[model samples]
Target: MKLPRSIEEIRSDFPILSVKVHDKPLIYLDNGATTQKPVQVLQVMDELYRTANANVHRGVHYLSDIVSERYEAARETVRAFINAPKREEVIFTAGTTASINAVAFSFGERFVHEGDEIIISGMEHHANIVPWQMLCERKGSKLRIIPFSDQGVLDLEAYRSMFTERTRIVAVTHASNVLGTINPVKEIVTEAHRHDVPVLIDGAQSIQHGIVDVADIGCDFFAFSGHKIYGPNGIGVLYGKEKWLNEIPPYQGGGDMVASVTFEKTTYNELPFKFEAGTTNFTGAIGLGTALDYLTALGREAVAEREQALLAQATGGLSSVSGMRIYGTAPGKVSLVSFLPGNIHPYDAGMILDKMGIAVRTGTHCAQPVMDRYGITGTIRASMAFYNTEEEIDALVKGVRKVTEMFA
Candidate 1:
C-alpha cells in the first residue's frame, strides 16, 4: 500500500500557517515542546463547548450524561492507543509532570523505605529528575544516576551495575527531548524487573514519534502529555500496571477519588479515580481522543518513514554547513537535531532564526545534566513532526547559513 507522498494535506489542516511573524512564512520546528493542533481536534473541543458542555460523572442531566460518555470514551481511546490492558489503568493528570508526581508521592511513600535507592538516567528532563530527587529526600532514600556515554547513548553497563536489592524504582525517558536518543526502554524495563524493581517510562517525547505499547514494553508505568501530541494543554495520561495501581496510595484527596468519608475514617475510590481527585480537563480529554484518532488514521508506519526521511535530509544538509556541530550523534535517534555553531551562543542563533520567522527551541531544554555532560551550555534544537515539509527544512538550512555568515 502506498502512503501519502508529502504531509501537505495534513499540514493544511492547521490554521496557524496563515499567520506571519515577520512578513515571512512560519517554519515551526519546535515540535518537541508542543505540536500544532489540527482542525479536527479544535472542532472536537468547539463542539463540546457549543453543545455538550458539562462536568462529567457528577450530574444526571442530559448534557452531563453526554459529556461523561465522551470522557469515558476518551479513556478507552487512550487505552487502545497505548495498548494498555484495561481502561481503569489509565489515569488523567495535568501532564507528564503531574503524572510523575502522582507516582512519586503515592508509590514512593508506600514502597520506598529509608536507605533504599531510586535509579534514573542523567539524560532525564527536570520533570523526571526533580520529582524523584524530592521523593528520595523525603523518604531518606538515595538517588542514583546512570551516566551516558560520550556518544549520547545510556551507559547500559553502568545501569546494570547500579541495580541491587535496595533499588525500588527505575525511571527514565523513552526518548531524550534534547538529545533525540531513543533509549532501549524494553531492555531497561526487563533488566529492572529481573531485580524485582518497578520501572516508569517518561513517554512525553516518544508518544508522537511512532507506536508505543506499555504491555509490549513491559513498563510498570508510562506518562505523556496531550499538548505534545496535538491535543489541548493541561491534559495527560498515566498508565500503570493494574497490580501496581492497586498497591499505590491515593495521590490527592477530593470529590471523585473517595468512596465513602466519615469523621473517623474514609474509604477511597478504585484504581484510576483514586489518582484523579478534582475537576478534570473534560474538553482536553475529548480533544486528545480526536488527536489520537487523526494520528491513527495516518498510520504509524507511514509517520515513522516520513519523519525519518526528513531527519536524514535535515541532518545531512546541516552537516554540510561550516562550523555546524550537531549534538546527539547516536546511531538511532528520533526526528530532532541539536547543534551549536562555532563561537555563537544558542540563544543568539535562535534569535537570528526567529527574525526569519523560523521557530526553534534554544536552551537546556530542561535537561541540564545532559548539557553538562556535553560540556556545553545549550544547543539550538530543531525538532520536526511528520507534518513538516522538505521546503521548510531548506528554509531552515538557509537561515542557519545566513546566521553563521553574519556572526563570522
Candidate 2:
C-alpha cells in the first residue's frame, strides 16, 4: 500500500464518504467530532468478533489465546504510534474522558493536597477541565486557568507565572478543538518542569494532525481518543510515564487488573493491566490498531499537507462571505476552521449546511468556557481530515454564503 497521491484515492477507503445525505452527496467536514472509519478498521474488528471472540488473559482455550495475543499486539501498536518508551505505558480506556478521569483520580489521590492547585487553560475541552474541577472540589484544592489571547493562542508567560508552590499538576490541550490552535506542549512541559511540576497533554484533537511523540514533548501523561482519528468510538488511550504509573494507585480494581486476590488480601496487576479493569474493549483496541496501520501507510506528512490545503481553501473562500468572522487566527494552527457569519446562530448555519449535504459542527463544541471568553454562544466548526477535498471545502464555503445571504 503506497501512500495515496490524491484525496479521491484516500476517500475510496471510507465507504461512508460515498453516501448521500438529503439527496445530495455528503461532504464530511466534521472530522474533529468523530471521523468516519475506513473499511480496514471495520474488517479487522469484525474478524476478531467473528473468529476469536473470548475472554482474554483468563482461559487457555485457543480463542482466548488468539484474542489476548491480538489485544496486546494492539497495545504495542498504540505504544509505537505515540512513541511511548514502553508498551506498558499505554492503557486503554473507554475514551479520552475516561483516560483523563483515571489520571485525575489516581494522580490526585497521590499528589494533590488540600491547598494545592491544578493548572489548565481557557481553551481546554470540558473533559480536561471538569475532572480537575472535581478533583479540586474533592480535595479542597484550587483550579487555576491559564488565559489565552483573543486569537486563541495560549499565553506561555501567563502559564509560567501561574505556577506557584501550591501548583501540583498542569493539564493543557495540545490543540484546541474549537479554535484549531496547536499549543506548544513541549515548551509547556519544559516550563512546568522548571517549577518541578508534571504536565499532562490532552491530545484528543492533536494526535490525528501529526506525530505526537510524548517523550519528545516530555509530558508526564497524554490522552487521546480513537474515534477522533478514524478508529472505533469506545476505545481511547492514556500514555503515562512508567514512574508516574508506578506511583499512582489503581483507578479501578477488578478481574485482569488484579495480580492475586484472596478474601482478605489482594495484589494488583502490573503497569497497564493495573488500570484496565473488568471486561476490556479488546475488539475496539484491534480496530484502533488497524486504524493506525491505515493512517501510517497513508503517510502522516502527506495527510497533513492535504489537510492544510483543504483548510486554506475553506478559509480563503469563506473569507469572501459578507460579515464572516473566523475564530482562532493564530499564526500556528491545524487544518480546522470555526467561525461565525454575522449574528446568525451557528446552529442555524450548520442546519442549513446539513440540508445541502455539507456536514459541519455547530454549537459550543463542548467548550462552553471558550464561548464565554468570546462573549458568544458558539461558532460553526468545519474540521478537515486527510480524506477531505478542496471540493468539499468549496461546498462548505458556498453553503455558508447561502446561509449568510438568507439571514442578511
Candidate 3:
C-alpha cells in the first residue's frame, strides 16, 4: 500500500506506530491524552541505564560527574526549547500536575491572601482547576472563571471584566485538551500584567503542536509534560520567571533543595534547585531532552505545518458525517477533533472504534467543566501528531461513521 510520503517518513521514527491492536493495524489518534514515544527518546534512556548510570549532583566519582553533566545539559536543552530566560528558571517536576501543584502551594503561600481571587477559564483541564481550588480553600481565596462560548473560545471581554483588585493571579490552558482551542495566551498575559497580576499557562496540550516561547508569551509560569511531546513519562517541566522563582517558597523539603541544614533552621538552595526537591526522574529528564532534540532537528515549524494539513483533512472528513456535533470550532486550533454524533454516547463510539484498532479518547477528557458547560457527558476525541497521515484521518472518519451506523 502506498502511504503519504511525509508522514510515512516521520512515522518510521516511532516504533509504536507499527503496533497492531486486535490483529488489525493500530491507528493511534489519542495524542492529546499522551503522545506515543519515539525510538530516539527510548534509545537515549536505554543508553543511560546501560553504561552511564549514576546519581546526579551528588558524588565526585567519574560516573557521577558524567551523569550530572548530562542531566544539567538536559536542563539547558529544555531552557532553550521553550526560550526561557535562564537555565535556573527551569524546574523539573513529575508532570504537568506536579508543576501546577508546585505553583499552587508556593506562589499561593507567598502572594495569595484571604478574599483574594484567582482567574481561570472554563475550558481548563482539571489539572489546572483542582490545584487552584485546593489553594483557594486553604487560603480563603476565591476562584473566578473566565467563561467560554458555545464554540469553546474564551470570552476575552468576560475575561477582562473578571479581574478586580482582589484578583492575584490567572491560570489558563494554552490549548484546551478536549477542544483543541489554541488560546491567546500572549494577549491574556498582557491583560493580566496591566493589573500587575501574573499568569500561568498550562502547556500540556500546546507544546507538542509547535514552538512555545515563554519569553514571547510573557507568562509568569508555564507547565507541560514530557509524554505529551513524544518523551518518557514521569517527567515534566515548570518554566517560571526568575522573579517568581525567587519569591516563591520551596514546594517540597528534601535533599539537594537545601544549601545547609541545621536543627533550628535551614537555608534553601537557590533558583531551580530550591524548587526541585529530592531525587527526580533523571533518566526521564534525559529522555525528554532527547525528545526535544528530535523536535529541534525536525524543526517545529515544519512539523506544525504538517499537522495543520492533517487537522484540515480530519475536520473536513469528520464534518461530512451526519448528525456530527464537533466542538471547539475555533478559527485557530491544534490538530485534534472532539465531537458527539446523534445521541450516541462517546464511550460506546470509542469502544467500537477500538475493536477496529483505532485508539481514541472518550468521555470528559479530564475537563469536566467543559462538558458541564456544553451539557455533554463527554466527547470522542481524536488528537493527531505530525506523524499521522491523511489515510489515518480517513480511517478515523470511516470508523466514526461505522459507529453511528452500528448504533442506528
- Candidate whose lDDT is highest: 3
Clashing pairs in 1: none
Error of 3 at 50 (Å): 0.8
lDDT of 3 at 205: 94
Per-candidate TM-score against the hidden true structure: 0.98, 0.98, 0.98
Model 1 Cα lDDT, one tens digit per residue, 172-229: 9999998899999999999999999999999999999899999999999999999999
The lDDT of each candidate is: 0.92, 0.91, 0.93
Q: For residues 1-408, what per-residue lDDT tens digits would candidate 2 score against the true structure?
A: 234666677788899999999999999989999999999998988888788899988899999999999999999999998999999999999999999999999999999999999999999999999999999999999999999999999988988899889999999999999999999999999999999899999999999987889989999999999999899999999999999999999988889999899999999999889999999999999899889888888887777777777788888998899899999988878888999999999889988999999988999999999999999999999999988877788888888989988888
Candidate 3, which ten residues in sequence have the lowest lDDT sum?
Answer: 1-10
Tell me the spans in candidate 2 whose CA falls farther than 4 Å from its real position. Answer: 1-3
Give the local distance difference test score of model 1.
Answer: 0.92
Residue 342 lDDT, candidate 2, scale 0-100: 96
* Total residue pair clashes for candidate 1: 0
Candidate 1 at 229: error in angstroms?
A: 0.5
lDDT (Cα, 0-100) at 218 in candidate 1: 96
The count of backbone overlaps in candidate 2 is: 0
Which 10 consecutive positions of candidate 2 have the poorest summed lDDT?
A: 1-10
Q: Report the C-alpha displacement of residue 145, candidate 2, in angstroms.
A: 0.7
